[model samples]
Target chain A: MIKAENLYFRYTEGEAETPFALNGVNLEIKEGEFVVIIGHNGSGKSTLSKLMNGIHTPTEGRIVIDGIDTSNEDQIWEIRKRAGMVFQNPDNQLVATIVEEDVAFGPENLGLPSEEIRHRVDEALDTVHMSAYKRKAPHHLSGGQKQRVAIAGILAMKPKCIIFDEPTAMLDPSGRKEVVQTIEHLNKNEKITVIHITHYMDEAIHADRVLVMDRGKIVMEGTPKQVFSKVDELRALGLDVPQVTLVSHKLKTMGYAVSDENLTVDELVAELCRLS
Target chain B: MSIIIKALTHIYDKGTPNETVALDHIDLEIASGEFVGLIGHTGSGKSTLIQQMNGLLKPTAGDIIVNNLEITKGLELPKKQRKKYAAERKKQLIEVRKKVGLVFQYPEYQLFEETVEKDIAFGPQNLGLVESHVKQRVMDAMALVGMDYETYKDKSPFELSGGQKRRVAIAGVLAMKPDVLILDEPTAGLDPQGRDEILGQLKTLHDQEQLTVIIVSHSMEDMAKIANRLIVMNQGKVVLDGTPKDVFKEIETLEAIGLAVPQISYLIRALNEKGFALPDDIITVQGAIDAIQNVLEKRAK
Candidate 1:
């Protein structure tokens, strides 16, 4: 569970004279939900994710993760332990070269017992379906495998929520699919709340909820269908609707009696069939 | 302008312990003015193959004939004869490089000039153009890529937006006025608008300039939209080479090679399997819509 009350954040000096990165943002994410945040560069989406994970303290308002106020420095480590963060580049976040050692790094830093750390590493790797690569070097694996290993490292901490900040931005399409599918599995099977920040509209299609941000605020928030239906608005904000949505929109504009509500190919086909 | 390869094999570090075969004994021909989409997973030797076409990398064995010039054979000649052949080859290479421009992945990393004008002029200037001719080519390239030359010419390339920066990087390659432009993942890190803008500019260039375009990407939707032919590579071998419709029809083989069909094609295949009258070769969204219209008309009849 995550709650934000008028979250205002600014990456600036002492006074509020400078501009805020996130301005007057209010959001609530339920436990065991998969929420995708999308926006163009500098739309405060990445800043929102950082605030959710306690990476940055809010400037003007409050953020509470599972009843733990992020403002309290004493509870920062505990909050971070509960909400793990995975960055864009897996190579940057991985602390050790060996896969198993890298997975154990998080638990070791958490000051868990040695036996508990070993157990956590094994369980985490197994959860990510990376147990077979435990003995290999992180550099030797594919981009998707490396990212999965990074997720396993985070899962070793046994976090309740995971915030992925453009996790697949550096990966190829296959690698992107691997990371997306792996996150979907984790959210479904483990019931771990997922906050995925991405620029890709396709990657956000299956999320339980979608949040579109722009100019330091949450401009739109709804289910994928609800949010994606505002194709013109998203395009005006420099974001893109899915290709199928664009085609359907074009057809509708040409007076083809096509449904604007269609997001996927199957829906588009069914709608076209009905029209005919 | 066509390129022909005969039994081309490239082995990295021959006779060494870490020797690996990057390219097999392959034979292929690329006709002039063909828009080919090269799709492969990373490390599938696609990059290696492209580099060899431009003489950026010499093959360990076999030969490459570009526009009837035997490039690989000239490397094996004796010193004096090689010097004469090298001089002739240099002329041929310059002509080839002028006709074939390569924009590597992360081409923005190659931008290192103080001003956009000078940066874009680098390619044409290297082609031994006069100052005025180079300036004209720079402006032409800038306009071709949808950049306002008047506004961007004096500014630092570092200050432009990401899309503009990518365009400037592309204009640098375009200034050479290449007949064949090879781009590797040109839309890799761009946002949707940026990606569309770049793709649109490339498409316009392909149409107006009649430039032969080779785009190496893994996005099936992108290939489906623009490419006339798709060349699928898996583990240093050409697994499939055909039109987008033809290549996507073999969904099972594509999946087996760790490549995904475009979402529209996948849906069409699924519908066809579920006893719908949809066509199997629907690769694009528009194509799928057309197929569905035909099926619906058939159902109505």
Candidate 2:
């Protein structure tokens, strides 16, 4: 469980006054729920993710991870261990030359026994479907594989919630699909609460709830169907809905009784055939 | 100028245990004044192939001829005449670099100048152009990328926004007056608005300058809208070379290589499979809308 109340953050780099990077944000996440946050670049999605895992302290308001308040200095480590972070660049998070060793780094730093660290490392690799590449050097792995290794490293810490900030931004389409699938599996099977931040609208279509942030505020929040149906609102926010949603919207404008909430090609096809 | 590749192959760390084939017997011919898009799965030799197109990476075995000049072949000449051949090859490469401007992905990270004008002028000044000519080229390059000379010329490149910094980086390449422009993932990490603006600018620049434009990107939608021709690479080979319409039709092949056709292509194909008689090669949004509208109108009649 994660909770934020009236959270505000400002990066004071310019003059005496710089606009808040995150202005008055409020959020709550239940255990094992998959929540996706979508926004344009510089909309504070990343800042929010950092705030969740104690990487960035809020300038105002409060954040509580599980049972510990983030503002409490002593509880920062506990909060971070409870909620791990997977950043955009996989290379930055991985510190080991080998894949299995990288996964072991987190638990080892937590002062776990060497045997326990080895066991956790194996389980984490298996969880991310990266067990086969345990001994391989990271430099030889693909981008998607490298990202999975990063996630496995976080998993070895045994965190309840994982915050991924644009983890698929640098990946190709297949790589994006691989990482998204891994995230979904972690949420569904492992019961890890997922706070995924991404710019890809299609990735958000399957989320339990989608939150849209703009100019440091939550502009919209709902189920994928409920959120994507508001085409004009999302477009006004400089956000893109799925292609199927766009096509269905066009068909609706042509007086066809088609739903504009379609998020996949198969959904649109089935809807069109149903109308016919 | 045209670029012709004859049996080009590149091996990294050759003769060592870590030896790996980066490019394998590849042949590609890019003509002057054509807008082309290169799409490939990661490690499919897109970067290696582009590096070879310029003189950055010499082919391990093969030749690259630039406008009737043998750029890569002469490098493999006999050692007896090594001194004379090496001089000629170096000269040719220097000349080739000026004609082929390659912009790597996230080029803004390479920007280091205190002022934007100084960064853009770096490429032209390297060519030994006179002061007046170099200044004119800097202004021309800035205009090509839609950066105002007066406002940005003196501004620190580090202080600019993400899109502006990227534009200035591209302008640095353009200042060299390259006839052929190759950009690797120019729109990576940009916001949607910024991505569209940069792509629109590239299209306009390609039109006004009549330069050979080759863009390597992973976004099928953006490439579909801008590129007239598309090259699909997989496993160090060009799997398909054709127009966007033709390339997108090989959906199964693209997917097999871990790439996808543009999103609208799937939508149009779905409609066609659902018996709407929609065209199959639809890659752009406007084209798909027009096709769907025509189908709906026909059904009404």
Interface RMSD over true interface Cα atoms for each candidate:
2.9, 1.6
lDDT (Cα) of model 2: 0.89
lDDT of 1 by residue, A1-276 (tens): 899999999887676466788999999999999999998877898889899878899998999998999999999989999999998876788779799999999899889999999999999999989999999989878888999999999999999999999998778778888999999998999999999998788988899999998889999999998898888999999898887787677777766777776678788767765665
Correct interface contacts retained, every candidate: 0.38, 0.52
* Residues B1-301, model 2: lDDT tens digits: 8989988888999999999898888888988888999999889999999998888987888989887778875666676765677777888888888889999988999999889999999888888899999999999999989988999999999878788999999999999988899999998878777788789888987898888999999999888889999999988888999999999999999999999987788888778877898777788777887877787677768
Cα distance off (Å), candidate 1, residue A198: 2.5
DockQ of 1: 0.41
Q: What is the TM-score of each candidate against the true structure?
A: 0.88, 0.96
Name the top DockQ candidate.
2
DockQ for every prediction shown: 0.41, 0.61
TM-score for the A-chain in each candidate structure: 0.96, 0.97
